[model samples]
Target chain A: MEMKFPMKKFIFYKRRTANFVMLSLSLLAALITIVPLVFIFYYTISKGISNLNIDFFTKLPTPVGETGGGMVNAIVGTIILIAIGGGIGIPVGIMSGTYLSEFGKNKFGILVRFFTDVLSGIPSIVVGVVAYTLVVIPMKHFSALAGGIALAILMIPTITRTTEEMIKLVPQSYREAGLALGIPKWKITVMIVLKTAWKGIATGILLGLSRAAGETAPLLFTSLGNRFWSTDIFQPIASLTVYIYQYSTAPFKDWNDQAWTAALALILLISVLSLVFRIITRSKYKA
Target chain B: MVVNEQVNITTEKTKSPHIAGSSLKISVKELSVFFGKTKVLSDININIFERKVLAIIGPSGCGKSTFLRSLNRMNEEVGGNFTGKIIFDDEDIMKLDPVYLRRRIGMVFQKPNPFPTMSIANNVVAGLRMNGFRDKKKLKEIVETSLRQAALWDEVKDILHESGANISGGQQQRLCIARTIAMQPEVILMDEPASALDPISTAKIEELIFELKKKYTIIIVTHNMQQASRVSDYTAFFYMGKLIEMDKTIKIFTDPELKQTEDYISGRFG
Candidate 1:
């Protein structure tokens, strides 16, 4: 097992060289991943910041060939759509996730989990079609409700799975402690298990919100993109993503400029959502 | 022979001041436990005296924890199947509601598990609060009393609103004990409660156990032999899921009737 001193030094150099090479390769890979994100942010901000002004946020889109207007209606419509989606998705996701983690250890649980994975993989366009048939067709028009429903369907799987994982991350000892106190199973799941994992679950919700906010395909057919201010759930509603899609494709230069601004605003909206949730759920004590 | 020894101990225990008028709080008859197809405990029979601390000591995998958990039906939470009767106040405990039974027979685990999301005061009263008890003044009183009983109040009184997990390990364990005490259970089960604690904390817990048994019957499972001797009035030695011996603590430590018990306690072998 003994090696000569010269051989040992040679081996050490070779090992050190391998370590250096691997570290450089990993650093290269990390840079490769970050480069595209940096480019996208840089391009979006530079092209969008010039068009962004107080009017861009306060006024409705101008008539065709007219110059000065904002996407205020689209912005408001997007918020309403997100509110509806969250109203439907958050409770369903949390309850189902709680069910899966706490009581779903059997065949039914496995089946439900499998279906959730499948649902997450289904194309957003296909969900749009499903919402089209279920809501738009039934109501006889493309509406904000249909778009919200489509987003809710898209959000459910992310929220459900993340919630289950987060709840599972809570130590088994916490459940045992609750049970030993003679608290009911439902109470323990709600008050102790859910409370402990809320920070993680909030992040999951934020992920779902960001994904839904960025969706263009689903809202394209479901909301159908209105030109005027409209807040009614039954009427067509404009959203930032849909406006970005419509304006970016039009031949007009100003519409294309506004599209970039809409993209920036969409990103800002998600960032604000994340910040608000962080502030709301911030831990009061050092952990 | 072991059954005859148990009878002698019962008769002898009746003479001690601590056991002079204390009645049988729980009786296990031919108890056995299984997790799926694997048996973990078999054909166990024991009588627990009221207001006395009975310690179960053995090597790892001897099913002492399973036995302690079975007392409160917490074993069923981990999917354990059981056979035979456990009588509490002349009723088969298996037929009783597991929730109600657990309320009557609370447990403290080997690791301190104060609810991390709760404040120190809130953790003490979590059981009551969760069960629909909403009286604020009563809850405050219960929190103070339970904290005092668990011997953690003075150290944590000023920081009652801090997170339960924001304390030292021993304090957290004592906080868990206070949480259990808030329920005012008839029995408290401790599963290697102080094995995770330092010596000073271990002494504090042992002293708490001594004070607690004046009101609640206790069953503790421990790997530490000296801890069993120091805290328990009666000690039962288990080897390979079987109770090798049960007797007064002094006898178990000084003059155990079985060779296995003597060997295990003297550190000859587990």
Candidate 2:
């Protein structure tokens, strides 16, 4: 018996409608997520553009009611803190990641991974409290060094996780190819596996840096805040996030305006660093 | 049919004692592989002579490639339990350091998987450098010679500094072969080296295999019977994890001793 043409036509129409609905829903979800990012950029530039100038970068923070103070101290402090934090974090993170991916098939490795995951989930405020006890109280003062250590602790788990994931993404075939050539296992991991995943590892490092750049709660109790330029890492240092937090709650109107400018500066710095890292990594594969 | 008759005559003549007394380079005895309690291959016994090409032919899941991998301890990477005695140059390979053993017996995989990050010349000399050869001049010589031997030097000579991935598919396979040969291994194991290539590239590989057999002992696992007949001196037919028959290549193709061998060669089953 031959089927009627109208029945076949109806079936085709139903399938096409189902596909259209799925595509439309996906598009809607994508737009919904992008809306917040667009708004954040628009608000930041519009509110902070008038005050963006060299003076805002070069001058120091003033008294609560005065204007014309720049964020030079905060900028320098942020640089020193990040440098110290990354110095402590990157090596340990890379080693831990290598241990987890290369030797983690055993019981000890499992414990290390468990601890790292736990550390990653701990709140920034908790890290601040811990740093206050371990570093601030023992040293008898709030110092930039203490804040850097706290941020390093936060950065380690992120770098380790990213490095482990990148290492795992390297194909086993590359390792076999290296081994078959009589290369030692360590050389294969370092020269072949690591080189292949270098881009991913870079991405991971940038992500960790971006995360550490905006942290405020940990620095509040450890580094506290400074009103003038301070190069000594052992002394209390001002950072952009902490400055914004401190100024936004003050009684003076000018301090609040300066807080908005500091916030804008931090956002710009992070975005530029991320963009540069991305460009550098992408160029590696382009050639 | 006429070609078969001529091949049979030549094979019978070559089976005489005078031709069968060549020196053995590799010998496997009671070699079996098990993947976590599941036995994949039974006892595999074979003697591979120097400067000869031996082809392993079988259906899928027949453990031919498994046997080939065991010769160089390539199976060690699979994380399985294996019991075997593979002797290369009178030394038990399983008892030796796998890294050292692999240096003497290199392998080429089915797919052409060159290191994506390295230049063509670097890929060729990677094995040499890995084994602690630091002399730049000598490394360059080996790279050039190996690529020339693999028939890739003329095409890639000018662009030796280019990424290996920039080459065509056939050239990449030859580059892999060149990389393996650069190790100066005495024995080379190929796991369906030509299966992924086009007809022209397949012919080039076959010709290269023939030329290479003069300097190295080769054991190849191939699904293409024509390739086995064209290139091999000895052929081993495997079925269901057991070796069914092994003889001179012509005998395996023309007048196999077992019914199953004849059925397989005739394309009745795999």
Candidate 3:
């Protein structure tokens, strides 16, 4: 009896230990996926913080070997590109998303969803090539407009997918409540569904914006680069990603420092945008 | 009880054409609803009179809510095939534009679903705004009156500009009631309006229903037999997609003509 009691207790301890081991392993796997993002943030901030200064944002980019310019031109170019790209992308993406969520249970909606998925998975380089053939070649020059169009193409799929998913999350009860009150179907979609899913949709657009902001590959063949400040949308303009890429590869310490600074600025801008969006969504939830 | 009195008045009026003939706000005939190949609700006939409360009582899946939804053509939004005639205020509701028909017959849901982003005043006046009402003064008046009618005026008057979602769940449900009233709809369909609320809130809603009967025709669907007994003048018992028995509330509960209704009321079966 004493031996049997000890044996049972030992088995219980062994089972508990095995369970804890399995739990820890699963947790480690999760952490493995999250650790890279942490590393990226740590690496970028530590490397770039010393070079961050007002001059990095207020002055123009220096030539290959020179040292006294900033990323002022790149900053302006990024803003212009994002604004025009968003302008081109938001309306079309929102409409398609609405179609998929509200009217897409049929064959046509399925077809649209299939194409959207395909568009979303296409390589950014492929988009650059397409934009080169369509906008840059047609205009007979490298231009900010071509870059914006390429970014817009990248943005559409993200926006559409997010919008569709967000709209789908809205409870059917809300739609039924609106319809029961005699509201028109289109009115329900706009006033009720859109309003209910606005935060999610906004977050989706921000995600698309962030993706476009960080892209260096697409603008490589399209926007090229400019040394001086340029406001013309139809002409080539320097952006932060392109500036970072160009300066980081050059053989000068100052140019390399400026690249780090530009990268830091880009990171800070996207983080602030995401933080503001999170606050808005959080307040909505509390309300 | 109020239910017995209302039934007597309804039957007497229907026979003599003196009391309820002019008050018949909605007349439904041979209504059937199908979701895809499966029929959800069979033929239902009901006459809703003005300034009276009609309660639809049944177990789950008895088509009570389905029948209630048919009043405002809410079923149309569910992608179902509906066959029947619903006449409201001398117009065939099916023949009328759904938007226009919905304007005249408002509905409240089981759950409190105030638009989270809108203010209390905005929620009350959503229907009016949808129909292009823009005058601030007129809107203010309607909002106040509707709130009063919903018995939510005092609780919400001080914070009308606060977000609708900032209020309590019960208050949100009352806000929905105010919203429907602001439309000035002739008929109001409520689908278990108090089901999600606490008992106190349910009582308040029941009291409000009594008050609302003075101005609008009310049709309510509920699983609570006591609630049907307390507020309604007429009771309709639905079973398995068909309306089994409809009579004065007291008679339906105490002296039901159908065994199924008797069994349901006695709690022997749902």
Q: Among all windows of ten consecutive residues in candidate 3 chain A, which has the lowest summed lDDT?
A: A278-287
What residue runs in model 2 are displaced by over 4 Å at the alpha carbon?
A1-5, A8-26, A279-287, B1-21
| Residue A264 C-alpha lDDT in model 1 | 92
Q: Which of the two, 2 or 3, has more lDDT?
A: 2
Worst 10-residue lDDT window for candidate 1 chain A reads: A1-10
Best by DockQ: 1
What TM-score does each of the candidates earn? 0.95, 0.91, 0.90
> Which pairs, if any, clash in model 1?
none
lDDT of 1 by residue, A139-195 (tens): 999999999999999999999999999999999999999999999998998998999
Question: Best candidate per TM-score, number?
Answer: 1
Error of 3 at A15 (Å): 3.7
> Considering summed lDDT, which 10 consecutive residues are worst modelled in model 2 chain B?
B10-19
The CA lDDT at A134 in model 2 is 99
Candidate 3 stretches with Cα past 4 Å from truth are A1-7, A23-43, A46-50, A275-287, B1-22
DockQ per candidate, 2 decimals: 0.69, 0.43, 0.49
iRMSD values, candidates in order: 1.5, 2.3, 2.4
Candidate 2 C-alpha lDDT tens digits along B1-270: 123332334334223111254566776676779988888888776767778899999999999888887877777677755786777777888678988888988998888878887889889998777667899999899889999999999999999988888998899999999999999898899999999999999999999999999999999999999999999998999999887788889988998888999999999988
Error of 2 at B133 (Å): 3.4
User: Model 3, residue B137: displacement in angstroms?
Assistant: 2.2
